[model samples]
Target: MSCTSSSMDIVPDDTFNDFAPLSKRRRVSDCSRSCEDSSCAPLKKFWFPDGDIVLEIQTRLLKVHRRRLQCSVIFSDMLHIPQPFETDQIDGCPSVALVGDALADWEVALAWIYHHDEFLNQVVTFDILSGALRISTKYEIPGLRRWAIEELSSRWPVDVVSMRLNALPHAAEAITLAQECNVPEILPAAFYALSVQKFHASADGGRSHLVLSPNDLRRLIAGREALQDALLRIAVDPLTEPGCANNAACAHCAPRRAEYWRARLAPDPKSPWSTWLVRELDWMLRDDAFAGTLCPACFHGHMSTIKWRLGRLRGAMPGFFLL
Candidate 1:
């Protein structure tokens, strides 16, 4: 049982009845008979001892305590009902069919309930954290859901460029999973990273599979184009020189400096505009290619202008990504 981001799905809203009795509670005899006659005896031995409830999860029987299930409001209400029969009990407790999710998901959820401290201390993997998130969200367990979200969000960098650089292993998956789980805060950076990275075919045959939704796809595409245009405009704008205060310096050096920058910062047809924006901005200000030709006032003024524009660009990044 391998767990990948692709295995994460939106836990159905109706999976757990929060306001009413569980629709799938099976008879104690049926659940107990299956547990006794099947391969679940080993799991029963491990989790069922002194357990008050039998949860038939898929083909397996998971014996869990009612006190542990009470941690979730959904489960608490589901388990609050009186037992139907004392004589039909298995291990001196009732049985219920826990439907919707697979046994693996329940395993993770139950582990979080019974051994929360240990689970939190363990090195959290994507599969485990994702399972916790799905179950927590399904059962309305706020603490577990918050923990899962924090763990997942930690994998993404706050800086957009860093996210773009590290996009390969998780960004696409993060975008898909975040949307599936209804976590909007994680989408902005993930979407920005995907927009800046080179588009590639996924296992689903195209990049379309990674998009959160049609609206999100539209926003990413539009934002990327807008950012490219904005960066190109900033790179090429002749206003970078900011009319030299020293008239003689302006007359002697402005034209050549402007010409040098225009030639140097010209867009590369092969590379993304974001790559050019990130890789060339600092060099454009630092490079001494035209230093020998420009006077002090003009050079300082131009550098200040470029720096100011860069600041503006940085400030506008969140808006560009619809953050």
Candidate 2:
């Protein structure tokens, strides 16, 4: 039941249908069935006698008011349909079976719907946000879906600069979620975050949870190589440092600056070049001592060149991933 990507496997493509009809609904699997009588218990927190409709999930039922769900086009249409004679009833309320959904997803979605004010004010977890996103997309709830996407965007931004600033946890899971759901925009950022992480083989020789799908692995490798190439090109490019007004001092400092860059920017076995560009740039810019040996003109020029080239690379990251 852990929602973190590190503990989960890649979700299959056909795991959930976006708008499956109720007529084609499949019965809950026998393993998930609570008892021999095929009866389901009400979920403790969501059950309410005063609620108008009862929703039957795999092993539990949830009673919620019609008004709360009517905002969703799919839910509204489903609710208006006349119930058949065989339709189950819970405490005189018509019960509808929800197909192709996980109970956890519904729990998160329903909690948000019923207590949105409180939920919005509270610190949201990835589990709650991802669950809400999945359920809202299934039910065609635009408002909740938008809210979930916007919340996720803050952590995994579309642009490279913001994405570098906001590091996301469980990036592999986020990538899977993007592929499974319709959130393609966050894929580039998620993939970039995953690329720099070092995943080791499991002790038992089993597949690691951090392992990505074959296609994703290919894309990650290609994109990471592309980024590394871009960084290397920028690092080795000739510096256009026109001698400052004090030409002698500036000329003397130039060779030292080149040597410093060669030593500091050289590729390290432990650290990836793709991730080092920003970190090194920040280090040099933050502390004047790092760039103190160079003349002001040379220092500013080198920094500007690094920024410009990296910015261009960042812009092309999505294309590098074949996205």
Candidate 3:
């Protein structure tokens, strides 16, 4: 029976050992048609003598309980399908080959199935969460996928307030991951973060154009230009507040704010991109000297106005990127 999560036909090969060095690992392609090939071996950790099924993944064979495999909806559905007249088997159990699935991801996802406590009690890295999400999504493991998405949502929030407080890591990868997993909620923040960090040459020194797909690159470019225009519009427009106690002071501050943004956004000869206005505004809010220039009432009022405008712009980020 076919039980692959991703696209591709399955081929099983010789011995599998998790502890083996990368250099010594073998591929199923390198083995002969017969199981008698010396290179093929069962993965010691996952191989169970009493297990009912042997999962062939590339060069490794993992014999696990059928019940545990059934936890995944896709696997469960596949298990119910009738077997062909001729079937592959390892030891005494039937073998199911999974093609085009990453062994590392399978390892992590399987760990979650067998050792749930380890993930529950520990802080999982981004790579681990990413792997789990991919595998669970591919395998239709709803519970595991939900847990991974929840963990990611905490880091990459959908709303403005939480987005401001958190710095999203792996911005480029996160964008692709969001699209792949159909997690549109995080796209705005992920795209915004990448735009702020400079897409051409990111803070990590990698070229974003090289990492992002053509469509994503186009969206990023368009969204970044929209952000620049939005910042200019906000800066040039009036910053009046009816509640301002000192209209005179507030009037002067408005021009100063516009000039501040203009100067901050001035094009640099060395770099074509400018800093994101949201980051600049965040810094301005914390600048005591800037705040000191206005009366307390005016300062708070103007700050509120700026925040409201930026918040609105931020909310439109998904559309800005055509997301």
Candidate 4:
């Protein structure tokens, strides 16, 4: 069931809790015929804050998630009845991968503008997993972000899922994407733990490789009093501090067994809390690893702390720090 509305509300998944184990990996057999076409052209790769995402997106042909055996067989029969193409053609056609671009690309496409319509025609496949988990990494992509929103309304698995704060791959990217898309539900898993962690801050800490800036540390203190009361919160904690690996998946990372046990109580069918996950956040926080995405509330808190910190530094050195 694909959305026809320009601003389609995402597929709704009221039946499942966010904390519940995500649905299983989609099989190659489950894909649609258009998605499966070998001739589909991949989306062009674009530059973002982090590494080359979707570097090979358009190269791969897509298939529908194979829940229907009959459909698959029929599609295969149709595909085998080959049709001719221009002999000079070296490139294939476009696929849905092209749809994922700057957020503006989505507005153009969804609005059915001619250029975007051409862009959509080029797309022959749509990744059912929606790459929300992928978005949860260092930075989010708008096309992918919108896709995830729609996917959220339907039942989909957390493909390649992980919440171990420490050593969590693409954690920062995922969080950033979530925040950009205005998907607040996932915010708790993304940033709260870091809000309560220790920190060493580089100015505008988030701009560079640093995750939880010094500003972030102060914000954490406000939410969890012990962080500041413990004395030099940022100075003491290794995980939350820069130059320290926040990934807890490594043998060196401290385990959070108690948090793991506590997480089981969540995933209730009757409450919004079911969509909230903390075992991973707790473990990450306990490990002192700060996930990258800062929710609106958290972002505001960090801004406040930075303003305060800068003000304090200015008072100490009239020439060096300015308000």
lDDT of 3 by residue, 127-234 (tens): 887889988887779989999888777777786345552444577787888888878887887788777664455452146776689999899889888988776565
Q: How accurate is candidate 1 locally (lDDT)?
A: 0.60
49 Cα displacement, candidate 3 (Å)? 3.2
Q: Model 4: how far is 153 from its true place, Å?
A: 16
lDDT of each residue in 46-131, candidate 4, tens digit only: 22222211111234422221121112222123223333232111123211232233333333222222234564445322232224
Q: Candidate 3: where is the Cα deviation over 4 Å?
A: 1-39, 82-86, 164-168, 199-205, 234-276, 279-293
Order the candidate numbers by lDDT, best to worst: 3, 2, 1, 4
lDDT of the candidates, in the order given: 0.60, 0.64, 0.66, 0.30
Report the C-alpha lDDT of model 1 over 133-219, residue by residue, as the tens digit.
Answer: 878877778888888888766665454433434344455667778777777766656665666565543422146445456676676
Clashing residue pairs, backbone N/CA/C < 3 A, model 1: none
Clash count for each candidate, listed in order shown:
0, 0, 6, 41
Error of 4 at 49 (Å): 38
How close to the true structure is residue 277 of candidate 1, measured as C-alpha lDDT? 52
- In terms of TM-score, which candidate is strongest? 2
**Candidate 3's error at 38, in angstroms?**
7.4
lDDT at 109, model 2: 84
